[model samples]
Structures are given as structure tokens and as C-alpha cells.
Target: MSVWEFFVWFFWFYIVISCISIFIRVIIDVFRDPELSGWAKALWLLFLVFLPFLGAFIYVIVRGRDMGRRGMTASREAEERIDDDIRSAATSTSAVSDIETAKRLLDSGAVTPAEYDALKAKALRGTA
Candidate 1:
């Protein structure tokens, strides 16, 4: 093929890729929009399926701003949940290790039975 033909093919390939990317993003946004009711989501899907280019343009024009907000909110919520899980895991692991150490001390005759019981209670209470 000639250079011009190659360039044309490349341009069309890029356009098709861009269109597909936008279409997928729109579909995801439609589902992510919690404000839309079930019927509304169904209608939107139908519209996009039947009239892809027009539906995409209109959806962007009408609800484009909320899409970014929804994505950011989702990302923030996920991060917060991960942080909470990590914090809980760290505390629980430390509590378990503390109890194990206290048990070892008791076995070695370094602490009395009463002291070991107190330590176990403290660890279980998360005050270790």
C-alpha cells in the first residue's frame, strides 16, 4: 500500500478505538449513576444500543459533569475502606502477638498466673 493509504488506515483505526473507548465509558457511567432509577437505566441502555453516536453525544452533553464526580466518589470510598481494613488488621495482629508473648512469659515462670490472665484480658480488650 501507498504511504497515503497507510496514513488513512491509521487515522480510521484511531477513530474506531476512540469511539469504542467512549462508548464503554458511557455504559459504565450509566450504571454508576445512582440517581437514575432502574427504568431510567433500561431506557438509557436501549437508546444507546439503538442509536449509538447520538446517544453518546446527548449523554455527554446532559450528564457529563456528574460522571467525573461519580468516579471520584467511588475512588475515595474504595480508598477509605482499604484504609479501615488495614487498620483493623494491624491492630488485631498486634493484639494476638501481645497475648502470645505474655503466654510465653508465663510459661517461662517470669509472670504469675494472675498477671498472665490480666495480660490476656487486656489483649482481648484491644488495650494491649
Candidate 2:
């Protein structure tokens, strides 16, 4: 093919691939959505399957705002979950260390049994 022809083909190929990727992403997102009912999901899937390009184009045009919102919501939720997990792990490790230190003090006679109990309770409460 001539250089010009090759460039035109490449441009078209890029556009087609981009459209297909968007379509697949939307389909996956539709199924992942908690707000979409099973029937609604099924109808959307049917439309997409039967009408590929038109359906994808229309879906993006119609639901584009909501699609963006849902994507942001999912991303925020995932980030929050990861943050919670990290905080839980850090808190647990700190609590364990605090309790261990208290136990060592009690064993070495630096702290009384009552003092050790209080420290343990404080550490546990701090974690919670």
C-alpha cells in the first residue's frame, strides 16, 4: 500500500479498536452496577449484542454522564476499602507492639500487674 493509504488504514483501525474497547468496558460496567436491575442489564446487553456500533454510540451519548459518575464511585469505593485495610493492619501491629511492651515491663518488675492490665486495656481500646 502507498504511505497515504497505510496512514488512512491505521487511523481507521485505531478508531475501531477504541470503539470496541469502550463498548466492552461499558458492558462490564453495566453488569457491575448495583443500581441496574437484572432486566435492565439484560436489555442493554441485548441491544449491544444485536446493534453493536449504533447501540454503543447511543449508550455513550445517552448514559455517558451516569457512566462517568459510576466509574468515579467505584474508584472511590475501592480506594476507601484499601485505605481501611491499611489502617486496620497498622492499628493491629501497633496495638500488638504496645501490648508486648507492657508485658515485658510487667515481667521485668518495672510495672505492677495492675499497671500491665491498664496498659493492655488502653492498647486494645486504642486499636478499636
Candidate 3:
């Protein structure tokens, strides 16, 4: 075959490969998304895998929610905020969780020894 014919075939082959790869990635992400109910998601994925190009195109247009980046970013930010809040609240709660509280409660007329010991056990257990 002529060199030009080989080059033309190579170019079309490259385009076909690129399109297939992009389609597969989109299909994978469509199934990876957490929004769809598990069974529906699984069936939709089956459709994509079995039906190829048409199913993939239709699935992205109908079911894919523009990839996961936006939702993932929002979830990550919320998780970080919750972690920060947990740390702040934990510091104050920790002060009340030490042996000092247990000892003080025991010495005072408030908690009996059994109650103090139980509370101490709970505090230590919780800390661990």
C-alpha cells in the first residue's frame, strides 16, 4: 500500500480509539455516581456495557449528572467543616472526661463510688 494510504488509515484508527476510550470513561463514571439507586444503576450499566455506542450516548445524556466533581467538592468541604467542629467540641468535652472529674465527683456528695467508677470506666473507654 502507498505511504499516504497507511497514514490515512492510521489517522482514522486514532480517532476511533479516542472516541471509544472517552465513551468507556463516561460509562464508568455514570455507574460510579452515587445518585442512582443501586439496582437501577446496575441495570443502566448493563445497558451501557452490552449496547455500546448508542447506549453510552443516551446514558450520558439521560443519566449522567455532569460527573462527580461538584458534588464531591461540596461533600469534602462539609466533611472538613464537621471535622473542625468535632475537634472544637472534643477539646471541651475532654476536660470533663479526665480522672479529675471522676475524683471530684467521688469526693463530693454527688456521685457514689460505684457511679464514679462506672463513669470513669465509660470516660476511659470512650477516650480509647
Candidate 4:
């Protein structure tokens, strides 16, 4: 075989591999995607199988932003949860300190009745 023949075969092989990889990735995304419902997943799979290139490209364009938003939402939620847990643990571990702080804040009118109740409960209970 000539060098041109080898080059053509290599190019064809590369193209096929790329298409297969794209298809697999798209399928996985469709399945694992939280935003997509069961019907949407089915439709996306149908489109991908029938109109592979167009379907994949459209999905990437449409759902890509949602994926980014989901990531941000998850990160923010995780941060908030960690902060809450730390606050709870700290209040429990430092009950006397928390009560002193709450008392000072209440005396200064910086805390509301509900806030005072919650803080006092945590202080008395030594856990919440």
C-alpha cells in the first residue's frame, strides 16, 4: 500500500473514533443529567441515535448552561450546609461562651425573641 492509502485509513479511523467517543459521552450525559426527566432522557437518546451529530451539538448548547448552574448551586448548598453544621457544633461545644454572647447581644437589642430563644435553648441544652 502507498503512503496516501495509509494516511486515508488513519484519518478514517480517527473520525470514527471521535464520533464514537462523542456518542458515548452524550449518552452518559443524558442518563446522568439531573435536569432531564425520564421522558426527556428518552427523547434525547432517540435524537442522538437517529441524528447523532445534530442531537449532540444541540444538547451541548442547550443543557451546558444548566450543568454549570447545577454545579454552582451544589457548591453553594454545600457551603451553606457546612457553615450551618459548624455553627451548630460550635454552639454545642462552647455553650457557656454562646450564652454569654447571646446575652450580650440580647441586652444590646441585637437579637430578636426567636433568636434569643434558639440561642438560649442551645446554651441550656449544650447541644442543638
Which has the greatest TM-score?
1
Off by over 4 Å in 2: 1-6, 94-99, 107-109, 113-128
In model 3, the Cα lDDT at residue 117 comes to 83
What would the C-alpha RMSD of candidate 4 be, to one decimal place? 9.2
Q: Name the lDDT value of residue 30 in candidate 2.
A: 82
Q: What tens-digit string does per-residue lDDT give for candidate 1 at 55-122?
A: 99999999999988998999999999999999988756667888999999999999999999999998
Query: Which candidate's lDDT is highest?
Result: 1
List TM-scores for all candidates, in order. Answer: 0.77, 0.71, 0.46, 0.51
| Candidate 3 structure lDDT | 0.76
Candidate 3 per-residue C-alpha lDDT over 50-91 given as tens digits, one digit per residue, 9 for 90 to 100:
887777778767655666574576679999999999989876
lDDT (Cα) of model 1: 0.93
User: Candidate order by lDDT, highest to lowest?
Assistant: 1, 2, 4, 3
* Model 1 ranges with Cα > 4 A deviation: 2-4, 94-96, 104-110, 118-128
Clash pairs, model 2 backbone = none
- Cα distance off (Å), candidate 2, residue 80: 0.7
Better of 2 and 3 by lDDT: 2
> 1 or 3, which is superior by lDDT?
1
Clashing pairs in 3: none
**True-structure RMSD for candidate 2:** 3.9
lDDT of each: 0.93, 0.90, 0.76, 0.84
